[model samples]
Target chain A: MRAGLDIDMPPSNDPFYAGLGQAVRIGTELLAALIVGGGLGWAADTYLFASGPWGMVVGLIVGVTAGIRNVMRAAQNWSK
Target chain B: MEESPLHPFELHNYIPINLFGLDISINKAVIMMWVVVGLAAFLLVKAGRSRRMVPTKLQSLGELLVEFIRDIILDTMGKGGLKFFPFIATLFVFILFSNLLGLIPGTYTVTSQIIVTAVFALTVYAISIVMGFILHGVKFLGILVPPGTPGWLLPLMIPIELVSQLARPISLAVRLFANMTAGHTILGVLFGLAIGGGLLIGWLPFAFTIAMNGLEVGIAFIQAYIFTVLTCVYIGDAFHLHGADDHAH
Candidate 1:
């Protein structure tokens, strides 16, 4: 057990854990982007436009696009 | 009488206080935070007192922690990110101690509270935004619009970038809160089983409870490291948004 607790052991360097972290980061980023965009759109619809779901519909589309873009960017960054 | 797995998380006011229409009671969670702060301060002060020619054990331990935090910041943000060392170090140590301390029986876990982690996350998020504006002025908005983006695509790209940026704190807070809550809840359930079962069957769950405790200790450390590293990454993004374009291949 003492040998297993070697200070020199590079624990975080494991690719598996790194990949898992990246996956979680990417998943959450995508979800958050959609929520924020749609949320802003909903707020605008409610307060400014009174245009029913039009604002939210646009917001969701914009959000999805943004989410995809974020995922792509994250993937690129991670690969580097 | 059966106890709920979440009974440990219930807030019981040690000294109930109401002032200015606010329930500012001293609860277990609040007391635990104070205890963690005191312990960290005491340990750090003692470690700093011994400036020996050859490092003492306490000093070495302190230096090791400092070096670990420094390495995380440097790795994620590079040399320019060193300026955030103090803030990041404090955040790391506080959360680490809080998580570890919660593992002891009859102690509350501060990080398990969504509000606590959310506040920490939001504060980091605000600092990153403020620092970006201070360092880059109007140019900081460039973070919302990646370089080499087509002129027509700006409408779509901007919102995506904005949402992605906003997600950082939410993820940061939720990750810590969920991890701590889940771990503790599992441990609680297992212990309840061990006690509820007769002596013949109880030992099985008791053994599992011990094993789970060990895993929780590792998770406590990991969550702290993750929280600090993400903060560094966010700060790094703000300071070096332009550099990101250069590195994008």
Candidate 2:
């Protein structure tokens, strides 16, 4: 009810706050995307190489890539 | 697939012994809470004693913490809320210290324990309820009655609001406890896997361990913020200042 105005502002040009906002935004999106990517990758790996380590490999690769993309997006939006 | 690793309910790794016939259980969780209490007390006192026009590093740290809690109170309760600063600041400092203590190796991470979290949550509930009734008397019951409800719906709205209100403490405790416990458990399991799965499978789990550790660090701070913020929200409801809407009218 108080709204967002009550929250404290970070020091101007503070790298810590900038990084934190970037991390929070990016991390949330990345986690969701990873769930989707991991599921897809797991399904593909199951069919291609049944019960293989490649499933984890593929999932990790895609999840990391998507996570990085989210980080970049957050940086663009949150930067002062 | 895998075993539960550890039960959240069971007091595993906890040992009990008799101390002055008190039968104290020396668990990791209890120790961590003591550490949190000690650290908060130490830092705040040290900071208070060392105050200066040009602040020392410890004093500056204390000021920053005070400002953080002050903002939360001001934003939620407004200027009139300043009186509650001691309570709010203490809660924030205790939670933050407890959470950060969990990050230390071999520390019990008391917030990971449900009892500690429950106690803190109940404290907030007690404060808000007591304050509400004391300040507003019978009008405090009106908290459940929103401003514009039809008279017919008063019976229905009141009970639902009461249930929801009661659940606030449970949810607050669960949110902090679950997040901290789950995060720490995940880190534990990942590293356990790295150690158990041989060096061949080491890199993958190791990477996860590091990333999750970093995430846990963020979560440590976040859970503290969230717990404190919700306390402010509850406090706002208690006083029913104009900006606090859910309890309005």
Candidate 3:
């Protein structure tokens, strides 16, 4: 029981748990940024402007960039 | 005989209640929530009742949980965060318990539902936003702009930061919901194959189901941990605007 308890002890120091936590977080951060940016772009195209395909195109690009930026920030935290 | 992998996720109301046209129904998820709250309260209260220099098992577990959550608050929010111990502790315990408890064969996973996770995420995000406004007033808007940015880039940078900021709650909700849903779906598919395969090839997928269940347990713990850490980080950012970018070399 003690050994089992030690597995989760100070997750920041435990390689396996920390590594797993970091991985899931980074994956979601990238995806979420993309979803937000793209969704906003789509909404703008549909509601605000009658732009055809252009709005979505710009939104996707921004989404990808934001996703990468999020991934970088998450990585920086991991390295620290 | 074919069954959808998502079949288990469907909810059936036990006692349907409509109040002011809102469907507030008693279902598996709702019952599970009550069970989780009751069990957690019982365990923690029982643990607290014991006063001994030599701690009992339950007492030690309670202490470890407290110290773990305390360390998280201290690391992210600093000494001032001790005020939020109760909030953080409740979030940790509730999430951790639900995630672990949902793994049982007959129990429903409350966190697997997008609505449940979304509500929790929105509440946390709203609290951070309100706290920032109350503490820093109008200056809380400065969070949209990073610490080191020239005037020329402000136009482009602000929109990008704005999108990322809006994505916070969305990411938090989607992450937990997707993980739990996907994990269970895979388990369901594997178990279905195991059952349908009969005595010959059934053992293989059955074995994988067991392995995946083990992995899911680890996922459960990691998800709860990440949720707590991010919650702390978000609130901490409200406490100190532009603090995260201070040491950028």
TM-score of each: 0.86, 0.70, 0.94
Candidate 2: misplaced stretches above 4 Å?
Answer: A1-80, B1-4, B7-23, B241-249
Give the clash count for each candidate.
1, 0, 0
Clashes by residue pair, model 2: none
**Cα RMSD for candidates in order:** 3.6, 13.2, 2.4
TM-score between candidate 3 and the true structure = 0.94
The true-versus-predicted C-alpha distance at residue A6 of model 2, in Å, is 21
The digit string of per-residue lDDT tens for model 1 on B145-199 reads 7779999988767776776777678778887898899999999899989988979
Candidate 3 chain B: worst 10 consecutive residues by lDDT? B240-249
lDDT of 3 at B163: 79
Whole-model lDDT for model 3 versus the true structure?
Answer: 0.84
> Per the 3 Å backbone cut-off, how many clashing residue pairs does candidate 1 have?
1
Candidate 3 differs from the real structure by a C-alpha RMSD in angstroms, to one decimal, of 2.4
Better of 1 and 2 by DockQ: 1
As for lDDT, the candidate ahead, 2 or 3, is: 3
> What's the interface RMS deviation of candidate 1?
5.4
The residue-by-residue lDDT of candidate 2 on B159-242, one tens digit each, is: 444444555676678767877778878887887788788878887998999998876776677678767766887878788823
The residue ranges of model 1 lying beyond 4 angstroms of the native Cα positions read: A1-27, A45-80, B244-249
lDDT of each: 0.81, 0.68, 0.84
Ranking by lDDT: 3, 1, 2
